[model samples]
Target: MKTLYKNYINTFKGLSDEIWWLALITFINRAGTMVIPFLSLYLKEDLNFSVSQVGWIMSAFGLGSVVGSWIGGKLTDKIGYYKVMVRSLLATGVLFIALQFLNTFVSLCIGIFIVMMVADAFRPAIFVALNTYSKPENKIRSLTLIRLAINLGFSAGPAIGGMIITGLGYAGLFWVDGITCVLAALVMIKVLNPKKAKVLDELKNDNPVSVYKDHAFLVFFIAMVLFGIVFLQYFSSITIYYKDVHLLSEFEIGLILGMNGFVIFIFEMPLIKWLERTAFTKLWLVFFGAVLTGISFLILNFTSWSGILIIGMLLVTFGEMVAFPFSNAFAIERAKKGNQGEYMALYSISFSVAHIFGHNAGLQLSAGIGFENTWYIITGLAFICAVLLFSLNRRLNNLKKIQL
Candidate 1:
C-alpha cells in the first residue's frame, strides 16, 4: 500500500512551479462554474423557454467563446498570457453579476454571449501558459494536471451549486459564480508575472502562422469538432434528457455529472502515465477514447436505471481522460515556438464551434425527433470520429519522432 501510494505521488512529480500554480488557478476558476451547468434549466424552467430557445441561447455562449478564443490568442502573442487571463477572469466575473438583471430572451442571449466570451478566453491563455512553463516532454503530464484541477473543482462546484440553487435560487448561483471568478483573477494577479511568463527568446518572433495552412492539422481539427459534437452533449442535451425523460431531480443530475469529475480525478493521472510508457500512440489513445465515449451513451439506450447513468458517466470520464490531454499536447506540438497561443486557440475553436453546432443542432433534433434518437446520432458520430482519428495514426507516429 505504501509503495503504491508513493508511485502515485511520483506520477505527478517533476512539473515546474508555474505548472502547479496554473493548475491551482484552474481549480479556483472551475470551482465556481455554477451558472453554465444550470443555464439550460434556468432558461427552460424559470424563463419558460422552449427547447429551441434554450439552444439558441446556448449557441450565443458558444459564439462568444469562439470570438474570445480568437482574440485571446492574438492578444497573448502580442501582449502576454498573464494579462489576458487576468482581464478575462475579472471581466467574466462582472458579467456573471450582470446576468442576474437580464430577463428577456434576447437580453439573456446577449448577456450569456458576453459572459462566455470573457469567461472562455481563459482557455487559450492557460494552454499558452502551460506550453511556456513546462518542458516539451512533460507537456502531457502538465496538461493532465490542469485537467485534474479542473475536474476536481468540477466535482465540487456542481454538487455545491446544486445545493445553492435549492437554497437561494439562480440569483445565488450567479453571485457565487461571479465571486469565484474574481477570486481566481486576484490569484492570477498576485501570482503570475507577465514578464516571467513571456515566450523564450529563441522561440519569440513577431511573425504569425496560420493554422488553416496545415492540412494534416486541419483534418485533425475537423475530427475533434465532430468528437466534441458528441462529447458536449453532456452539457447541453443530456441534462434536459435527465430531467424530462428520466425524471431525475437537479441534485441527482448534479451527482451524476459530478461523478464524471470524481472518476477523472481518481484515474486520469495514473492512466496517463501508464499510456505514456506503453505502445499506444497518442492518436490511437484518442480513437479508443471516442469508442469509449460512444459506448457510454449507447448504454443508455439499453438501460434506463439510475445506476446505468453512473456507469455511463464513468465510461465518458475514462474517454475524456484518454483523449483530451493528449490531443492538447498534439496541438501544442504543432505550434511554432512563438505561436503557441494561436495553435492552442485553433484547438479551443474546435470546442467552441462544436458547442455552437452541437448544442443548437442537438437541441433542435431532440425537440423535433426525440432524446433516444439523439443518443443514436451521437453514437454514430463518435464512431465516425474514431475512424477519422485512426487514419491519422501514421502521421501522428511520425510526429512523435520530432521533439516538441
Candidate 2:
C-alpha cells in the first residue's frame, strides 16, 4: 500500500502549474456553455420562436462569434490573453443577465448576439494561451487535452441546463451561465498568470506578421476551412434530419443527439493519444476519419435500429476526435512563435466561415433536395472538401520543411 501510494504521488510531481491553470480556465470558460447547447430548444419551446426565426437568431450568434474572434485576435496581439479573458467573461455575464429582462424577439436576438460576441472571442484567447504554454515536445497532446476539457464540460452542461430548464426555466439557465461567467472571470483574474513580455517589444505591436506568407500556415488554414464545412453539419444538417424524419419519439431524438456527446466523452482522451503519433505518420488517419463522419450521415437515413444510429454517432465521435485536434495542432505547429492568439483566431475563422454557409444553406438544401439525398450529396461534397485539403497539404510539404 505504501509503495502504491508513493507511485501515485510520484506520477505528477513535476507537472507544470501552468497546465493546471489552463485546465481550470477551461472548466470555468466551458461552464458558461450550459446556456448555448440548449439555445435552440430555448428559442423554440421556451420563447415560441418559429424554426426559421430560430435559424435567423442562430446566425446572429454566429455573426457575433466571427466579430468576437477578429476583435480577440487584434486585442490579444495588442494587450494579452489576461485582459482579453477577464473582459470577455465579465461582458458575457452582463449579457446573460440582460436576457432575464427581455421578452421580445429582437431583444432576445440582440442580447444573445452580444453575449455570443464575448463568449466566442474568449475561445481564440484561450487557444493562444494554451498553444504558448507548452513546448513542442508535448504541445499536440496539450492541445488535445485542453479541447477534451471543453467537450467534457459541453457534454454535461446541456443535461444540467435541461434539468434546470425543467425545474426552474430559461431564466434558470441564464442564471447558471451568468454565475459561471463571473466565477470564470474571478478565476482568470487570480490564477491565469502568463509570462510578461519585454516592454519594448510590447510597445511596437503592429499587425501580426503574416504567418501565412510562409506556406504551411496558409495551406493549413485553407484546408481547415474546408474541414469546417464538413464538421459543422452535426448541428445544422443532422438535427434537421432527425426532425424531418420523425422516426422517433422526442425522447428518442434527445437520446440520439445526447449520445454523440457521450461518445466524444468516452473516446476523446484515449483517441487523442492514439492520433498524436498517427498525425505525425501518414496523415491519412485524419482523412479516413473524415470519410467515416461524412458517410455516417447517409447511414443514419438507412438504419432504424437504435444500435446502428448509436454506432453511427460513435463514428462521428471517432472522426471528430481524430480530425479536430490535429487540425488545431497542425495550425499551432506552424504558427509564429508568441502569436498563438492570432494564429488561433485565424484558424477559428475557418470554422466561422464554414458555418456561415452551413447554417444558412444546409436547411434550404435539405428542404429542396430531400433530407436523405442531402446526406448523399453532403458525403460526396465532404470527399471533395477532403481532397482539396489533402491537395493543399501535398503542395505545401516542401515549403513547410523550409523553416518549420
Candidate 3:
C-alpha cells in the first residue's frame, strides 16, 4: 500500500503542470454548476412558476452563452486566460450568492442568466488556455484528462447538491455552489500561474471569427448544436420527468446522473484510444454518437425507471463522451495557428446554442404535448443532426488538407 501510494504520487508528478491547473479549474467550474440541475425544481417548487415559465427563464443562459463564447475567446486572446477566468469566476460567485436572496421568478431568472453568461465565459478562456499551454503531441491526452476532471466534478456535484437540496432546500444548494466557485478560483490562482496569466494588451488586428467559413468545421459544430437540443433531458427535462413521472427522490436523480460520470471516469481513456486506432475519426464517431443518443431518448420514452433507462443513459453518456472531445479536437485541428482561441470559442457556440434549443424546445413540446412526446421530437432532431454530421464527414474526407 505504501509503495502504491508513492507510485501514484510519482505518476501524478509526471503529468504536465497544466493538468493540475486544468483539474482545479474544471473542479471549480463543475462544482459551481451543481446547482443547475436543481434549479428547475427550485423554480417550480420554491418560486411557484409553471413548468412553461421555468423553461422560458432557463433558456436565458443559452442566449447569454452565444455572447459569452464570442467575447470570452476574444478576451482570452487579448487579456490572457488566467486573468479572464479568474475574473469570470469571481463575478459568477457573487451572482450565484445573490440568487439566494431573489424571491421573484423574473428576478431570479435574470440573475441566474447573467451568472451563466459569466460562467460560460470560462468555456472559451479555459479551452484556449489548455490548448495553448500543452504541447501539441499531448493535445489529445491533455484534453482527455480535462474531460476526466470535469466528469469527476460532475460525478460529485449532483450527488452532493442533491443531498443538500433534499436536506436544506434549494437555497442551501446555491450557497454550497457559491462557496465552491470562489474556492475553485483560489485553488487555480495558487496552484498554477502560467506566464499567459499575466496582463497583456489586446490584439487589435485579431481575426478570430473566420472560423465560420470552414465548411467541415461548421458541419461538426452545427451537429453539436443540434445534439445539445436533445441533451437537456439530462439536466432540465429529465429531472422533472423523473420527479413527476417516476416519483424519484433527489438522491435517486443524482444516482442516475452520477452513473454517467462514473462511466466517463472508468472508460474515457480507453474509448479515446479505440476511437484513434480505427477509422472512427471524430466526425464519424460523432455521427454515430447522434444516432446512439437519439436511440437512447427513444428508450426513455418507453421506459422511465428500469434496466432500459440505465442503458439509455449509458448510451447517451457514450455518445457524449465520444462527441464532446471530438468537437474540441476537430475545431482546434482545423483552425489556423495563433487563432486557436477563436476556434474554440466558435465551438462553445454549440454547447451554448444547444442550451437554448434544448431547453425551450423541451418546454414547448412538454407543455403542448407531453414529456414522452418531447423525447420523440428531440430524438428526431438528433437523427437530423446525425445526417448533417455524416455529410460533414464526407466533405472533410473529400477536401484537400490545408497545410497550415
> In the order shown, what is each candidate's alpha-carbon RMSD?
2.3, 4.3, 3.7
Relative to the true structure, how large is the alpha-carbon lDDT of every model? 0.86, 0.67, 0.77
Clashes of each: 0, 0, 0
Error of 3 at 270 (Å): 2.0
Q: How close is candidate 2 to the true structure, as a TM-score?
A: 0.84
Worst 10 residues of 3 by lDDT: 196-205
Better of 1 and 3 by TM-score: 1
For model 3 the TM-score comes to 0.90
Runs of candidate 3 exceeding 4 Å displacement: 1-15, 196-209, 401-404
Model 2 clashes, total count? 0
User: What C-alpha lDDT, on a 0 to 100 scale, does residue 401 get in candidate 3?
Assistant: 63
Model 1 Cα lDDT, one tens digit per residue, 1-404:
99989989999998888788888988998999867778888889878999999999989988988898888888887788888999999998888988889988899889888888888788888888888888877889999999999999889888888888788887898888888899988987787776565332225657756777877788889889999999989888888988998898888888888888888888899999999999987788988999999998899999778778888888999999999988888888778633777888889989999988888888999999998888899999999999889988877667767846
Pairs with steric clashes in candidate 1: none
In candidate 2, position 21 carries an lDDT of 70
Candidate 1: what lDDT?
A: 0.86
Question: For model 3, which pairs clash?
Answer: none
Per-residue lDDT for 137-169 in model 3, tens only? 555656777888888888888988888888888
lDDT ranking, best first: 1, 3, 2
Model 2 scores worst on lDDT over the 10 consecutive residues at: 196-205
